[model samples]
Target: MSMIKKRRMIEIQQLQDDSEKQNVTRFILEALPQWFGILEAREEYITESVNKMFFCAYDQDRPIGFLYLKETGKDTIELFVMGVLQEFHRKGIGRALFYRAKRAAREKGYSFIQVKTVKMGIYEEYDRTNQFYQSLGFKEFQVFPMLWGESNPCQIYVMTL
Candidate 1:
């Protein structure tokens, strides 16, 4: 059985090769400036993803979305970063990538999954991001008032596997 899934001409695949992960991570993040506008932060994500679990969603041969998972603890994993092309939003690519990552985490014996984002209401872009995570059953766990900065407070969301 393959982890690859295809629907509506979009396909999702888990990438194990480091270079491919870096390539896809850079490509997808570059395509999503609204979510990954900070050059420093985006570069950090791309570099870190090379050593994390990576999954990519592609339309034909064009990578459109990606998710990276990092182990946060013996029993916990975090969705370090994720993004889908703006044109592909609400079309299930993000959801598919998430479920794939979740399944992989459970198989690896992870008991909890978490993600962090800019706290909602501070920005419209992040408000949608907050809602997306909530729609996937992630519950708000905490808020770090100045984790990112005074303006971009960080909100953590978690789910039990």
Candidate 2:
């Protein structure tokens, strides 16, 4: 049987402790496999204790989505990773986490926010992800054929804040 989604009040904020890092790691492992199943060589960011800009979306204190941001340059922040639990998809949790990160970046005077993902249409899940970010005003910045190797061309999106 299909389950119903509950109307939720989600709070977005920076991840503040090792416990939250664990929570986000669990969430990503659970949520992203559907999209990134082929890429087993997971990056160190999620596996290690988060010592970077990390944020999460919580529903009554339970984490539903998480995002990590890093200052890639003097005036730009790169969205290193983001994931929303499968069951919580399409419920605005990801958007909440993204905007919270964007707000924080903007407040810190970052000139741009960028995200790199596997080129959109190559994967169904990432296609939706691209659409979501485009809806948030992030436009195509560049596509690097060798960034993640030929199979996983990296598409970078950017929004000028």
Top candidate by TM-score: 1
Model 2 regions more than 4 Å off: 1-6, 38-40
C-alpha lDDT of residue 122 in model 2: 85
Locate the minimum summed-lDDT window of 10 residues in model 1: 1-10
> Looking at model 2, which ten-residue stretch has the lowest summed lDDT?
36-45
Cα lDDT computed for each candidate against the true fold: 0.92, 0.80
Residues 1-161, candidate 1: write the lDDT tens digits. 78976556888899999999988888888988888889999999988987788899988899999999999999999999998888999989999999999999999999999999999999999999999999999999999998888999999999999
lDDT of 2 by residue, 1-161 (tens): 99999666878878778667866766676556776464444445556536777887788877777888888899998888787888888888888888888888999999999998889778787799889888889999999989988888999999998
Backbone clash total for model 2 is 0
- Superposed by TM-score, candidate 2 places the C-alpha of residue 98 at a distance from the truth, in angstroms, of 1.0
Separately for all candidates shown, the number of backbone clashes (residues 3 or more apart, or on different chains) is: 0, 0
Candidate 2 TM-score, true structure as reference: 0.86
Screening candidate 1 with a backbone cut-off below 3 angstroms (N, C-alpha, C), the clashing residue pairs are: none
Q: Which stretches of candidate 1 lie over 4 Å from their true place?
A: 1-7
